[model samples]
Target: MSKDAFAAAALALTAAAENGSNMCLSFLNALPVTHAAISTLGAPFGSETICASDSQAARLEELQIDFGAGPCWDALRTRAPVVDADLSEPTESAWSLLREAIRDTGILSLYSFPLAIGELNVGALDLYATTRAALNLPLIARASALADLAATPVARQVIRRLPHLDTDDTNPATYSRREVHQATGMIIAQMRVNADDAQALLRAHAFTLGRPVREVAADVVARRIKFTRDDVVDRD
Candidate 1:
Protein backbone atom coordinates (compact mmCIF):
# COMPACT_ATOMS: atom_id res chain seq x y z
CA MET A 1 0.00 0.00 0.00
CA SER A 2 1.07 3.60 -0.53
CA LYS A 3 1.86 6.09 2.23
CA ASP A 4 -1.39 7.90 1.41
CA ALA A 5 -3.35 4.72 2.14
CA PHE A 6 -1.74 4.36 5.56
CA ALA A 7 -2.42 8.00 6.30
CA ALA A 8 -6.06 7.49 5.38
CA ALA A 9 -6.22 4.42 7.60
CA ALA A 10 -4.84 6.42 10.51
CA LEU A 11 -7.44 9.10 10.07
CA ALA A 12 -10.28 6.59 9.71
CA LEU A 13 -9.16 4.66 12.78
CA THR A 14 -8.90 7.86 14.77
CA ALA A 15 -12.53 8.53 13.95
CA ALA A 16 -13.35 4.90 14.78
CA ALA A 17 -11.77 5.37 18.22
CA GLU A 18 -14.70 7.64 18.98
CA ASN A 19 -17.40 5.83 16.95
CA GLY A 20 -16.51 2.18 16.88
CA SER A 21 -19.10 1.27 14.25
CA ASN A 22 -16.81 2.54 11.54
CA MET A 23 -13.85 0.33 12.38
CA CYS A 24 -14.28 -2.37 9.73
CA LEU A 25 -15.00 0.17 7.04
CA SER A 26 -11.80 1.97 7.97
CA PHE A 27 -9.75 -1.18 7.44
CA LEU A 28 -11.45 -1.93 4.15
CA ASN A 29 -10.59 1.53 2.84
CA ALA A 30 -6.93 1.08 3.73
CA LEU A 31 -6.25 -2.50 2.68
CA PRO A 32 -6.31 -4.36 -0.60
CA VAL A 33 -8.80 -6.89 0.65
CA THR A 34 -12.44 -7.08 -0.38
CA HIS A 35 -13.92 -7.23 3.10
CA ALA A 36 -12.99 -6.68 6.75
CA ALA A 37 -14.31 -7.40 10.21
CA ILE A 38 -13.49 -6.43 13.78
CA SER A 39 -14.35 -8.78 16.57
CA THR A 40 -13.72 -9.28 20.28
CA LEU A 41 -12.83 -12.79 21.29
CA GLY A 42 -13.27 -14.14 24.83
CA ALA A 43 -13.07 -12.67 28.31
CA PRO A 44 -14.29 -9.26 29.44
CA PHE A 45 -15.84 -8.71 26.02
CA GLY A 46 -16.91 -12.20 24.91
CA SER A 47 -16.61 -13.40 21.31
CA GLU A 48 -18.69 -11.30 18.96
CA THR A 49 -18.33 -9.27 15.81
CA ILE A 50 -18.00 -5.57 16.55
CA CYS A 51 -18.26 -4.53 12.93
CA ALA A 52 -17.97 -5.93 9.40
CA SER A 53 -17.60 -4.33 6.03
CA ASP A 54 -20.31 -6.52 4.54
CA SER A 55 -22.50 -9.54 5.15
CA GLN A 56 -19.81 -11.98 4.01
CA ALA A 57 -17.31 -10.51 6.46
CA ALA A 58 -19.86 -10.75 9.27
CA ARG A 59 -20.63 -14.38 8.41
CA LEU A 60 -16.93 -15.25 8.46
CA GLU A 61 -16.55 -13.88 11.98
CA GLU A 62 -19.77 -15.53 13.11
CA LEU A 63 -18.54 -18.89 11.82
CA GLN A 64 -15.34 -18.57 13.82
CA ILE A 65 -17.23 -17.66 16.96
CA ASP A 66 -19.66 -20.54 16.48
CA PHE A 67 -17.01 -23.17 15.76
CA GLY A 68 -14.51 -21.76 18.27
CA ALA A 69 -11.79 -21.95 15.63
CA GLY A 70 -10.48 -20.01 12.63
CA PRO A 71 -7.67 -17.71 11.56
CA CYS A 72 -8.94 -15.13 14.04
CA TRP A 73 -8.71 -17.58 16.92
CA ASP A 74 -5.24 -18.63 15.77
CA ALA A 75 -4.15 -15.02 15.51
CA LEU A 76 -5.23 -14.35 19.08
CA ARG A 77 -3.85 -17.63 20.46
CA THR A 78 -0.44 -17.13 18.88
CA ARG A 79 -0.49 -13.33 19.22
CA ALA A 80 0.61 -13.17 15.61
CA PRO A 81 -0.83 -12.67 12.17
CA VAL A 82 -2.54 -15.65 10.46
CA VAL A 83 -2.40 -15.56 6.70
CA ASP A 84 -3.84 -18.02 4.21
CA ALA A 85 -3.07 -16.40 0.90
CA ASP A 86 -4.75 -19.08 -1.16
CA LEU A 87 -7.86 -20.75 0.16
CA SER A 88 -7.82 -23.24 -2.70
CA GLU A 89 -4.95 -25.22 -1.20
CA PRO A 90 -5.36 -27.80 1.54
CA THR A 91 -6.27 -26.27 4.89
CA GLU A 92 -3.87 -26.36 7.79
CA SER A 93 -4.66 -28.96 10.46
CA ALA A 94 -5.58 -26.25 12.92
CA TRP A 95 -8.13 -24.81 10.55
CA SER A 96 -9.75 -27.92 9.09
CA LEU A 97 -13.22 -27.32 10.48
CA LEU A 98 -13.20 -23.61 9.64
CA ARG A 99 -11.90 -24.30 6.17
CA GLU A 100 -14.66 -26.79 5.45
CA ALA A 101 -17.20 -24.36 6.82
CA ILE A 102 -16.01 -21.54 4.59
CA ARG A 103 -15.21 -23.52 1.45
CA ASP A 104 -18.42 -22.68 -0.33
CA THR A 105 -18.34 -19.04 0.71
CA GLY A 106 -16.30 -17.92 -2.31
CA ILE A 107 -13.47 -16.45 -0.22
CA LEU A 108 -10.11 -16.81 -1.96
CA SER A 109 -7.84 -15.47 0.73
CA LEU A 110 -7.94 -14.68 4.45
CA TYR A 111 -5.81 -12.70 6.88
CA SER A 112 -6.17 -12.11 10.57
CA PHE A 113 -4.30 -9.90 13.02
CA PRO A 114 -4.49 -10.08 16.79
CA LEU A 115 -5.65 -7.01 18.63
CA ALA A 116 -3.82 -6.63 21.91
CA ILE A 117 -2.44 -4.02 24.29
CA GLY A 118 0.09 -4.97 26.93
CA GLU A 119 -1.36 -8.22 28.36
CA LEU A 120 -4.92 -7.49 27.38
CA ASN A 121 -6.15 -9.74 24.57
CA VAL A 122 -8.79 -7.46 23.09
CA GLY A 123 -9.70 -9.31 19.87
CA ALA A 124 -8.83 -9.56 16.16
CA LEU A 125 -9.06 -7.82 12.82
CA ASP A 126 -9.88 -10.09 9.87
CA LEU A 127 -9.60 -9.33 6.18
CA TYR A 128 -10.57 -11.48 3.23
CA ALA A 129 -10.56 -11.30 -0.54
CA THR A 130 -13.06 -12.83 -2.90
CA THR A 131 -10.41 -13.19 -5.56
CA ARG A 132 -6.99 -14.77 -5.01
CA ALA A 133 -4.48 -12.35 -3.48
CA ALA A 134 -1.50 -12.25 -1.17
CA LEU A 135 -0.53 -9.64 1.38
CA ASN A 136 3.16 -8.88 1.03
CA LEU A 137 5.36 -8.14 4.04
CA PRO A 138 4.69 -4.42 4.02
CA LEU A 139 0.93 -4.87 3.88
CA ILE A 140 1.01 -7.39 6.71
CA ALA A 141 3.14 -5.02 8.79
CA ARG A 142 0.74 -2.17 8.17
CA ALA A 143 -2.24 -4.35 9.11
CA SER A 144 -0.53 -5.34 12.34
CA ALA A 145 0.11 -1.71 13.14
CA LEU A 146 -3.53 -0.84 12.53
CA ALA A 147 -4.67 -3.73 14.73
CA ASP A 148 -2.46 -2.43 17.54
CA LEU A 149 -3.96 1.02 17.24
CA ALA A 150 -7.48 -0.46 17.40
CA ALA A 151 -7.01 -2.45 20.61
CA THR A 152 -7.20 0.34 23.19
CA PRO A 153 -10.40 2.04 22.10
CA VAL A 154 -12.02 -1.35 21.45
CA ALA A 155 -11.26 -2.37 25.04
CA ARG A 156 -12.55 0.91 26.38
CA GLN A 157 -15.81 0.53 24.45
CA VAL A 158 -16.42 -2.88 26.03
CA ILE A 159 -15.40 -1.74 29.54
CA ARG A 160 -17.75 1.22 29.38
CA ARG A 161 -20.76 -1.08 29.16
CA LEU A 162 -20.21 -2.71 32.53
CA PRO A 163 -22.42 -1.63 35.41
CA HIS A 164 -20.85 1.20 37.39
CA LEU A 165 -20.00 0.54 41.03
CA ASP A 166 -19.61 3.06 43.84
CA THR A 167 -16.10 3.39 45.18
CA ASP A 168 -13.72 5.88 46.77
CA ASP A 169 -11.58 7.85 44.35
CA THR A 170 -7.83 8.39 44.59
CA ASN A 171 -5.19 10.36 42.73
CA PRO A 172 -4.32 9.23 39.23
CA ALA A 173 -0.67 9.45 40.32
CA THR A 174 -1.30 6.40 42.49
CA TYR A 175 -1.64 4.29 39.35
CA SER A 176 2.12 3.78 39.49
CA ARG A 177 2.28 3.26 43.25
CA ARG A 178 3.77 0.21 44.96
CA GLU A 179 0.31 -0.93 46.02
CA VAL A 180 -0.77 -0.91 42.38
CA HIS A 181 2.13 -3.13 41.46
CA GLN A 182 1.38 -5.48 44.31
CA ALA A 183 -2.28 -5.53 43.41
CA THR A 184 -1.47 -6.31 39.80
CA GLY A 185 0.65 -9.22 40.95
CA MET A 186 -2.24 -10.50 43.01
CA ILE A 187 -4.56 -10.29 40.00
CA ILE A 188 -2.00 -12.09 37.85
CA ALA A 189 -1.90 -14.94 40.31
CA GLN A 190 -5.67 -14.99 40.59
CA MET A 191 -6.55 -14.72 36.91
CA ARG A 192 -3.51 -16.42 35.35
CA VAL A 193 -3.14 -13.52 32.91
CA ASN A 194 0.06 -11.63 32.15
CA ALA A 195 1.21 -8.60 34.15
CA ASP A 196 -0.03 -6.21 31.49
CA ASP A 197 -3.39 -7.96 31.27
CA ALA A 198 -3.74 -8.02 35.03
CA GLN A 199 -3.09 -4.30 35.25
CA ALA A 200 -5.48 -3.66 32.37
CA LEU A 201 -8.18 -5.62 34.21
CA LEU A 202 -7.57 -3.51 37.29
CA ARG A 203 -7.75 -0.28 35.30
CA ALA A 204 -10.84 -1.47 33.46
CA HIS A 205 -12.57 -2.41 36.68
CA ALA A 206 -11.76 1.02 38.10
CA PHE A 207 -13.07 2.72 34.98
CA THR A 208 -16.29 0.71 35.17
CA LEU A 209 -16.77 1.67 38.81
CA GLY A 210 -16.04 5.32 38.09
CA ARG A 211 -13.12 5.34 40.54
CA PRO A 212 -9.44 6.02 40.32
CA VAL A 213 -7.41 2.99 39.26
CA ARG A 214 -5.24 3.31 42.38
CA GLU A 215 -8.24 2.93 44.66
CA VAL A 216 -9.07 -0.36 42.97
CA ALA A 217 -5.46 -1.46 43.24
CA ALA A 218 -5.53 -0.66 46.95
CA ASP A 219 -8.64 -2.80 47.36
CA VAL A 220 -6.92 -5.72 45.70
CA VAL A 221 -3.90 -5.23 47.93
CA ALA A 222 -6.18 -5.28 50.96
CA ARG A 223 -7.96 -8.41 49.74
CA ARG A 224 -11.18 -6.46 49.46
CA ILE A 225 -11.51 -7.68 45.88
CA LYS A 226 -10.44 -10.88 44.20
CA PHE A 227 -10.31 -11.66 40.48
CA THR A 228 -11.23 -15.02 39.05
CA ARG A 229 -11.30 -16.18 35.46
CA ASP A 230 -15.09 -16.06 35.52
CA ASP A 231 -15.87 -13.14 37.78
CA VAL A 232 -14.62 -10.45 40.14
CA VAL A 233 -15.35 -11.32 43.76
CA ASP A 234 -15.92 -8.67 46.41
CA ARG A 235 -14.58 -9.69 49.83
CA ASP A 236 -16.16 -6.74 51.59
Candidate 2:
Protein backbone atom coordinates (compact mmCIF):
# COMPACT_ATOMS: atom_id res chain seq x y z
CA MET A 1 0.00 0.00 0.00
CA SER A 2 1.23 3.48 -0.76
CA LYS A 3 2.06 5.54 2.32
CA ASP A 4 -0.64 8.11 1.48
CA ALA A 5 -3.36 5.47 1.02
CA PHE A 6 -2.44 3.76 4.28
CA ALA A 7 -2.63 7.10 6.06
CA ALA A 8 -6.14 7.78 4.65
CA ALA A 9 -7.52 4.39 5.65
CA ALA A 10 -6.07 4.66 9.11
CA LEU A 11 -7.72 8.02 9.47
CA ALA A 12 -11.14 6.74 8.34
CA LEU A 13 -11.07 3.68 10.55
CA THR A 14 -10.03 5.81 13.45
CA ALA A 15 -12.91 8.19 12.78
CA ALA A 16 -15.38 5.33 12.41
CA ALA A 17 -14.13 3.88 15.65
CA GLU A 18 -14.61 7.22 17.32
CA ASN A 19 -17.93 8.30 15.82
CA GLY A 20 -19.32 4.89 16.73
CA SER A 21 -21.13 4.52 13.42
CA ASN A 22 -22.28 1.00 12.76
CA MET A 23 -18.82 -0.34 12.00
CA CYS A 24 -18.63 -3.97 11.00
CA LEU A 25 -16.51 -5.92 8.57
CA SER A 26 -19.09 -8.43 7.47
CA PHE A 27 -20.92 -9.02 4.18
CA LEU A 28 -24.01 -7.39 2.67
CA ASN A 29 -26.73 -9.29 0.83
CA ALA A 30 -29.45 -6.71 0.44
CA LEU A 31 -29.55 -6.73 -3.35
CA PRO A 32 -29.94 -10.40 -4.15
CA VAL A 33 -26.16 -10.80 -4.33
CA THR A 34 -24.38 -11.73 -1.12
CA HIS A 35 -20.73 -10.69 -0.99
CA ALA A 36 -18.91 -12.07 2.04
CA ALA A 37 -15.92 -9.79 1.87
CA ILE A 38 -16.63 -6.72 4.03
CA SER A 39 -19.50 -4.50 5.15
CA THR A 40 -20.78 -2.39 8.02
CA LEU A 41 -24.06 -1.56 9.71
CA GLY A 42 -25.62 1.10 7.48
CA ALA A 43 -28.99 1.84 8.94
CA PRO A 44 -31.02 3.55 11.64
CA PHE A 45 -30.42 0.91 14.31
CA GLY A 46 -34.00 -0.41 14.41
CA SER A 47 -35.70 1.34 11.53
CA GLU A 48 -33.85 -0.32 8.66
CA THR A 49 -30.72 -2.36 8.00
CA ILE A 50 -28.74 -2.14 4.78
CA CYS A 51 -26.42 -5.07 5.19
CA ALA A 52 -26.03 -7.52 2.34
CA SER A 53 -29.10 -9.66 1.97
CA ASP A 54 -28.53 -13.40 1.62
CA SER A 55 -31.68 -14.02 -0.38
CA GLN A 56 -30.59 -11.37 -2.87
CA ALA A 57 -27.19 -12.95 -3.29
CA ALA A 58 -28.74 -16.37 -3.65
CA ARG A 59 -31.14 -14.96 -6.20
CA LEU A 60 -28.25 -13.66 -8.26
CA GLU A 61 -26.38 -16.95 -8.00
CA GLU A 62 -29.59 -18.62 -8.98
CA LEU A 63 -29.77 -16.43 -12.07
CA GLN A 64 -26.27 -17.44 -13.09
CA ILE A 65 -27.38 -21.03 -12.62
CA ASP A 66 -30.85 -20.77 -14.08
CA PHE A 67 -31.20 -17.90 -16.58
CA GLY A 68 -27.42 -17.73 -17.22
CA ALA A 69 -27.16 -13.92 -17.05
CA GLY A 70 -27.27 -10.98 -14.67
CA PRO A 71 -25.28 -8.17 -13.06
CA CYS A 72 -23.35 -10.50 -10.82
CA TRP A 73 -22.08 -12.38 -13.84
CA ASP A 74 -21.19 -9.15 -15.62
CA ALA A 75 -19.64 -7.73 -12.49
CA LEU A 76 -17.58 -10.87 -11.84
CA ARG A 77 -16.64 -11.19 -15.48
CA THR A 78 -15.76 -7.55 -16.16
CA ARG A 79 -14.59 -6.71 -12.66
CA ALA A 80 -16.46 -3.39 -12.86
CA PRO A 81 -19.47 -1.70 -11.34
CA VAL A 82 -22.89 -2.58 -12.80
CA VAL A 83 -25.79 -0.30 -12.11
CA ASP A 84 -29.46 -0.35 -13.07
CA ALA A 85 -31.39 2.57 -11.69
CA ASP A 86 -34.43 2.15 -13.90
CA LEU A 87 -35.10 -1.48 -14.44
CA SER A 88 -38.51 -0.87 -15.97
CA GLU A 89 -36.94 0.98 -18.84
CA PRO A 90 -35.59 -0.82 -21.89
CA THR A 91 -32.61 1.51 -22.02
CA GLU A 92 -31.03 -0.26 -19.06
CA SER A 93 -29.85 -3.30 -20.95
CA ALA A 94 -26.81 -4.32 -19.00
CA TRP A 95 -28.75 -6.20 -16.33
CA SER A 96 -31.82 -7.58 -18.05
CA LEU A 97 -32.16 -10.78 -16.02
CA LEU A 98 -31.16 -9.03 -12.85
CA ARG A 99 -33.78 -6.38 -13.52
CA GLU A 100 -36.49 -8.96 -14.00
CA ALA A 101 -35.53 -10.74 -10.83
CA ILE A 102 -35.41 -7.50 -8.92
CA ARG A 103 -38.82 -6.59 -10.31
CA ASP A 104 -40.21 -9.90 -9.15
CA THR A 105 -38.92 -9.19 -5.67
CA GLY A 106 -40.48 -5.70 -5.68
CA ILE A 107 -37.11 -3.99 -5.76
CA LEU A 108 -37.06 -1.21 -8.35
CA SER A 109 -33.38 -0.33 -8.61
CA LEU A 110 -29.89 -1.59 -7.81
CA TYR A 111 -26.16 -0.93 -7.93
CA SER A 112 -23.17 -3.27 -7.91
CA PHE A 113 -19.60 -2.13 -7.38
CA PRO A 114 -16.79 -4.60 -7.72
CA LEU A 115 -14.35 -4.62 -4.83
CA ALA A 116 -10.85 -5.01 -6.13
CA ILE A 117 -7.38 -4.67 -4.67
CA GLY A 118 -6.09 -4.43 -8.22
CA GLU A 119 -6.61 -6.69 -11.23
CA LEU A 120 -8.12 -9.34 -9.04
CA ASN A 121 -11.89 -8.95 -8.66
CA VAL A 122 -12.04 -9.92 -5.01
CA GLY A 123 -15.84 -9.62 -5.08
CA ALA A 124 -18.62 -7.05 -5.35
CA LEU A 125 -20.71 -4.97 -3.00
CA ASP A 126 -24.34 -4.52 -4.08
CA LEU A 127 -26.49 -1.70 -2.74
CA TYR A 128 -30.20 -1.97 -3.39
CA ALA A 129 -33.36 -0.24 -2.40
CA THR A 130 -36.99 0.06 -3.44
CA THR A 131 -36.75 3.31 -5.40
CA ARG A 132 -34.86 5.23 -8.08
CA ALA A 133 -33.07 7.32 -5.50
CA ALA A 134 -29.34 7.44 -5.97
CA LEU A 135 -27.15 5.95 -3.26
CA ASN A 136 -27.30 8.24 -0.27
CA LEU A 137 -24.60 10.71 -1.22
CA PRO A 138 -23.35 10.91 2.33
CA LEU A 139 -23.37 7.16 2.75
CA ILE A 140 -21.61 6.70 -0.55
CA ALA A 141 -19.17 9.41 0.32
CA ARG A 142 -18.45 7.69 3.61
CA ALA A 143 -18.04 4.34 1.92
CA SER A 144 -15.74 5.94 -0.64
CA ALA A 145 -13.71 7.40 2.14
CA LEU A 146 -13.62 4.09 3.91
CA ALA A 147 -12.67 2.32 0.72
CA ASP A 148 -10.07 4.87 -0.16
CA LEU A 149 -8.55 4.44 3.26
CA ALA A 150 -8.72 0.69 3.51
CA ALA A 151 -8.78 -0.55 -0.08
CA THR A 152 -5.03 -0.87 -0.58
CA PRO A 153 -4.39 -2.34 2.83
CA VAL A 154 -7.59 -4.29 2.90
CA ALA A 155 -7.18 -5.46 -0.67
CA ARG A 156 -3.67 -6.67 0.12
CA GLN A 157 -4.92 -8.24 3.32
CA VAL A 158 -7.73 -9.85 1.38
CA ILE A 159 -5.28 -11.17 -1.23
CA ARG A 160 -2.80 -12.47 1.36
CA ARG A 161 -5.83 -14.21 2.75
CA LEU A 162 -6.48 -15.70 -0.66
CA PRO A 163 -9.83 -17.39 -1.12
CA HIS A 164 -11.18 -15.16 1.60
CA LEU A 165 -14.38 -17.09 1.52
CA ASP A 166 -12.71 -20.27 2.74
CA THR A 167 -13.84 -19.60 6.32
CA ASP A 168 -17.24 -18.70 4.92
CA ASP A 169 -19.79 -21.16 3.62
CA THR A 170 -19.07 -21.67 -0.08
CA ASN A 171 -22.69 -20.89 -0.76
CA PRO A 172 -23.77 -18.44 1.88
CA ALA A 173 -27.41 -18.93 0.94
CA THR A 174 -27.27 -22.71 1.05
CA TYR A 175 -25.74 -25.65 2.92
CA SER A 176 -24.57 -27.78 0.00
CA ARG A 177 -20.89 -26.86 0.16
CA ARG A 178 -19.64 -30.31 1.21
CA GLU A 179 -21.51 -32.08 -1.55
CA VAL A 180 -19.98 -29.68 -4.04
CA HIS A 181 -16.42 -30.01 -2.74
CA GLN A 182 -16.79 -33.76 -2.55
CA ALA A 183 -17.80 -33.63 -6.18
CA THR A 184 -14.72 -31.51 -6.91
CA GLY A 185 -12.47 -34.07 -5.28
CA MET A 186 -14.04 -36.79 -7.37
CA ILE A 187 -13.39 -34.70 -10.48
CA ILE A 188 -9.73 -34.33 -9.47
CA ALA A 189 -9.40 -38.03 -8.90
CA GLN A 190 -11.13 -38.91 -12.12
CA MET A 191 -9.07 -36.41 -14.10
CA ARG A 192 -5.88 -37.48 -12.28
CA VAL A 193 -4.71 -34.00 -11.45
CA ASN A 194 -4.68 -31.25 -8.83
CA ALA A 195 -7.78 -29.36 -7.68
CA ASP A 196 -7.31 -26.12 -9.64
CA ASP A 197 -6.76 -27.88 -12.94
CA ALA A 198 -9.67 -30.17 -12.21
CA GLN A 199 -11.90 -27.17 -11.58
CA ALA A 200 -10.81 -25.54 -14.84
CA LEU A 201 -11.50 -28.71 -16.78
CA LEU A 202 -14.88 -28.96 -15.19
CA ARG A 203 -15.74 -25.34 -16.00
CA ALA A 204 -14.52 -25.69 -19.57
CA HIS A 205 -16.51 -28.84 -20.06
CA ALA A 206 -19.63 -27.26 -18.65
CA PHE A 207 -19.34 -24.23 -20.92
CA THR A 208 -18.87 -26.49 -23.92
CA LEU A 209 -21.59 -28.97 -22.97
CA GLY A 210 -24.09 -26.18 -22.19
CA ARG A 211 -24.44 -27.02 -18.50
CA PRO A 212 -23.58 -25.67 -15.11
CA VAL A 213 -20.20 -26.59 -13.69
CA ARG A 214 -21.82 -27.51 -10.39
CA GLU A 215 -24.20 -29.80 -12.21
CA VAL A 216 -21.36 -31.31 -14.24
CA ALA A 217 -19.27 -31.67 -11.13
CA ALA A 218 -22.17 -33.41 -9.42
CA ASP A 219 -22.34 -35.83 -12.31
CA VAL A 220 -18.66 -36.53 -11.84
CA VAL A 221 -19.37 -37.42 -8.22
CA ALA A 222 -22.33 -39.58 -9.14
CA ARG A 223 -20.32 -41.37 -11.81
CA ARG A 224 -22.73 -40.23 -14.49
CA ILE A 225 -19.93 -38.40 -16.35
CA LYS A 226 -16.74 -40.33 -16.85
CA PHE A 227 -13.61 -38.22 -17.08
CA THR A 228 -11.21 -39.98 -19.39
CA ARG A 229 -7.95 -38.50 -20.65
CA ASP A 230 -9.19 -39.32 -24.13
CA ASP A 231 -12.40 -37.34 -23.53
CA VAL A 232 -10.30 -34.32 -22.60
CA VAL A 233 -8.18 -34.80 -25.71
CA ASP A 234 -11.23 -35.34 -27.88
CA ARG A 235 -12.65 -31.99 -26.78
CA ASP A 236 -9.47 -30.34 -27.88
TM-score list, all predictions: 0.73, 0.39
Tens digits of per-residue lDDT, candidate 1, 1-236, equal: 89898988988887877765578888888888888998999875688898889998899889988988889988998999998888888855776868867767988888999987655577999998876665788999998998877876677667667654323335545445788889989988997766765766787777645677777888899899888754555667
Query: Which segments of model 1 are wrong by more than 4 Å?
Result: 165-202, 205-214, 217-236
Q: Provide the overall lDDT of each model, using Cα atoms, as 2-decimal numbers.
A: 0.80, 0.45
TM-score of model 1 (CA atoms): 0.73
> Which is the leading candidate under TM-score?
1
Q: What TM value does model 2 have?
A: 0.39
> Evaluated with lDDT, which candidate comes out highest?
1
Q: Could you tell me how far off, in angstroms, the CA of residue 97 lies in candidate 2 after the best superposition?
A: 2.8
